[model samples]
Target chain A: MSRETILASIRAALPPGQALPELDNFGLHYDDPIQQFITTAEAVGANLQSVDNRGGIAAAVQAFLPGASSILSHVPEVPCKNFTRDADRDPHAYSDLDLIVVEGLIPVAENAAIWVPDSQYDDHAAMVLTQHQVIIVRASDLVDHMHQAYAKVAAAEVPRFGFFLSGPTKTADIEQSLVLGAQGTRSLLIIMIRDESTSTI
Target chain B: MIDHAQHARNFTANAERTAWHDDALWFVREKRDKATKLIPEWEELREQASQVKMHMLSRLDHYLEEFERNATARGIQVHWAEDADAHNRIVHAILERKGVKNIVKSKSMLTEECHLNPYLAERGMDVIDTDLGERIVQMRNEPPSHLVMPAIHIKKAEIGDLFHEQLGTDAGADDPKYLTEAARQHLRPKYLEADAGITGVNFAIADTGGIVVCTNEGNADLGTSLPPIQIHCMGMEKLLPRLEHLGVFTRLLARSATGQPITTFTSHFHGPKPGGEMHVVIVNNGRSAILAKPEFRRSLSCIRCAACLNTCPIYRRSGGYSYGSVVPGPIGSVLSPAMDLEKYAALPFASTLCGSCTDVCPVKIDLHDQLLAWRKYVVKEGYLDKGKARQMKMAGKLLSSPTLYRTASFLSKGMKLVPRVLLYNKKNKWGMERELPLPAKRRFRDLYRKRPRS
Candidate 1:
């Protein structure tokens, strides 16, 4: 078989195996991870909002994204007519969506990336097809760096598909000039709920 | 094979374009330095990344097998290709079996190496490159100038002309945002209509049997998410032992490439989405030959960050097309010779032996040292030009014997008194671009002998 032949060639060429390096605390630690998260996220061209409680989230969304014609969110507090979880629908149907809000399971401080499990999202296409994406996470959920973020994912059975999204889709392909929206969400809004009681409520 | 010096001469003829190219790449290098400076453990991370690659290459067969088994169990069809020909044929067979006509592709340097686009197009398949930069160069029918920034050599004005002719934009619309938007409009329907999507894998996790594809634009996601059939091609060296290893690579990749903390989309695909069918092709393509050489084995550690390309002085001045290979700059100078020494013999000579590439490498590949090694090997293989070899031989003989060296020095001094036309003839190539310095009337040895006691 071709597989056997390729593997044999690889085996023949290999030198003695070396031990894998430890990947623990591989970078600087932050005194306040949330502050670092906000600074890093903003640096990458993401807008942020700290909602006092879950009740104010919808109002904050209205205030932030007033131009959104259509809004879709799985969050119970925020009202949306077009929910992503509606069953037996084509994924491409979400292509015209103006806004889609989802909850972030974990946040990393070093880069303002949110860990969104595939299971939580009704369709992964929602994250990419929309004009703008809003990810809501508790301020306390932010970790110091990628190492800690991976520890959280490795501790449990990670979903079949997940991603660490930092900001809106962007490209520098034209002339190496950074452009915010290029085929994906134009803007990323992070609503970090500081009140612990409203994180789950 | 084309001579690198001749090819570079064509690129450097336009002094303004060369300066633009140099400044553009240097700007990326500065951004990389700034991004890396923020992390205190940047050096430690590079060391760790290097070790990970070395360890993986040592047990490559084992990890590939583990990854194959796990990926197969997850219902992803895994195929193996011994070389570029086999890789192209395998992808063709897959598309033929599925009766797919239109193919949408993201930025996969592997596909470029295999020349998959022309191969499929010859078979009456429409292959559309979805990445904006890739699309621009594809329309022009030219290979990518740089790995990360494909159209770096082409100016915005040229792109505006290309887009104007191809996409029917304004006669001279050169704005990056406007050009990008025009491309987005042009490519959206292609994405929805593509029968299959092919992507290059950034990292293949053995433990999870999944592949990670990172892109600044969400084109890869759109290409894979909407299509019914997805094909991913990756070099065997892209494997990692576990998913956690992704954390380390992810942190290092974007920061080193374009100075972003992370790419906009770091999508991880464990298997085909919903009802789609996914296939992963693992290509050897001379990678095993690299692994066999102990001295040059560290070249396998490259993560395709192109940090070396951004920082290389020779690459900046000469432009990427100067090197007669798809991959250019310092890393390509080291790698291309390993593949075809005769064809790429001039690449090793293209560098200034500056250590800037090594300093900025995320994997610590010792790029400059490898480049120097390639120079020695290429010369030993008798691939050097005959005239240059004769000159070196004569210079060697003259330097080894003191009597001959003194005679040559004395003769050279006398030649300065001769007419400039006699010495600055066509036989003397060095005098073409520069003037020869005047020789002193007194020899250093005679002057020292006659000097008064200090």
Candidate 2:
């Protein structure tokens, strides 16, 4: 079998096993994760908005994307034309979505990434198909770097597929010229809710 | 096939294009420098990443078994391939079982190394490259120039023309935004229609049995999520012992490759979603041979960030195609020689030994030192050019003897008076682009003897 052959080759080539290094402190920490996350997110080309309650998500989305019309979302308070959870539709049905608002489980400060799992949003196609994306995270869920983020996920029952969404999709393929919104969402609005008891909704 | 110097010479024939290419890569290098400077613990992070890879390499077998156990327990099929041919066959079998004719693939250099596209294409299958840069190069019928930025060598106008011809974009649309949107419209349907999706693993976490894929575009995620079958291909070296170690690598990969804080998407796949089948193909492909050699073994730690390519002076001017390898740069110079010593004997000599590639490597591969070592190995294997070997031997003998060296120096000084005809011809390869230096009249030994004692 190829498996046995490959494993034998690896065993023959490998040296004796060595102890793994300590990696808990590999990531950098910030004095204020929220401020740092906001600064880093904006630097990576994401518009930021802050709110105190869940109701403010609608206001923030409207303010961020005033011209948005074809909205599809799963967040309870966000305004949308269609809810992906309402029906058993194909992922491609939301191909022309103008805006998608989903809740992020955790906010990482080092790179401004927010963890969004498949369980949080059933139709992940909305994350990539929409013209604009808004990911809401509780301020209390913010961490300093990826180390803490991974620790949290490992501690919790993270689903089969989870992704860290940092900013809007971008590309620089044309002579290294920076261009946002190549194939995915063009604009990203990261909203941080200050309320401590912000539900998964 | 082993004429790297001649290839580089032809590449630099267009002086304007050479300068532009050099400046373009330098711009990327500068961006990397700026981004790295932002993180105060960047060096420490690189060292930590290196140590993590070192530990994984030593215990690779154990981790592979562990990963396979967990992955299989989660209903994920894990296939092992001893070489490129086996890897292609495994992928083909999986696709053939599903009767998949069309596939959407994200950027995976491993697949390129395996020649999977053509292997499937010859069998009447269509492999659609989904990454914007990869799609651009695929349409042009060329291999990727840069690892992260696949179409970096092509001009915007060329891409515009290609898209206009193939994707029906406006003929004069050279704008990057317009071209990207055109590709999006073209690929959206293909993503949904593809029977399976193939992606390369950035890091295979043993603890979680998860493969992490980082892409600025959500192409990998979109392809995998939409398809019923997800086939992830990875080299044996792409493993980390723990899930927490991902923080260290994720911080360094994007910043080193494209100066971004992070890619827009860093997705982790532990297993297939509901009703979906996930297949993980682990490929050796000469990685075991590389691992056995102590000097070149550090190369296995590479994360495919292509930071070395951006920092390499030789790579910028000569272009990626000049190296005649799928991966073409300082790392390529070291890697290609190991893969085919006789065919790629000239690659190790393509570099200037500037050590810039070594400095920028996220995993600290010791690239320049490896290049020098490959040169020594190539010569030891009797692959050196006959004339160059003779010149080096003669110089070595004369330099070992003071009298003979002085005589040779004296003769060289007198040869300045010889006609330019003898020195400027094609036989004198050194004089083709550079003039020979005028020899000094007096030797350093002679001048020192005549000087007054201090």
Residues B1-454, model 1: lDDT tens digits: 5488788778888999889989999999999999999999988888889999999999899899999999998889999999999999999999999899999899998999899999999999999998888999999999998989998888888999999999999998899999888988898888778889999999998988889999988889888877789999999999999888887889999999999888878888888777889999999999999999887889998889999999999899888888978799999898889889999998988888879999999999998899888878977999887766777788899999999999988898888678989778766655765798877789898899999997
Identify the runs in model 2 with alpha carbons over 4 angstroms from their true place: A24-27, A84-88, A195-201, B439-443, B447-454
Complex DockQ, candidate 1? 0.77
B311-357 per-residue lDDT for model 2 (tens digits): 89889999998888988999888888889999999899888898999
lDDT of 2 by residue, A84-120 (tens): 4544567677777888888899899889999998877
- On a 0 to 1 DockQ scale, where is model 2? 0.75
How well does candidate 1 match the true structure, expressed as C-alpha RMSD?
2.5
lDDT of 1 by residue, A1-201 (tens): 778888888888998889998876754689888898999899888899987878778987888788888888878877775544674568778778899888998899999988988766688777787789888888878888887888888787856678888888888877688888888888899999988864573
Q: What residue pairs are clashing in model 1?
A: none
lDDT of 2: 0.88
List candidate 1 stretches off by more than 4 Å. A82-84, B402-454
* Model 2 chain A poorest ten-residue lDDT run: A79-88
Please state the error at residue B119 of candidate 2 in Å.
0.8
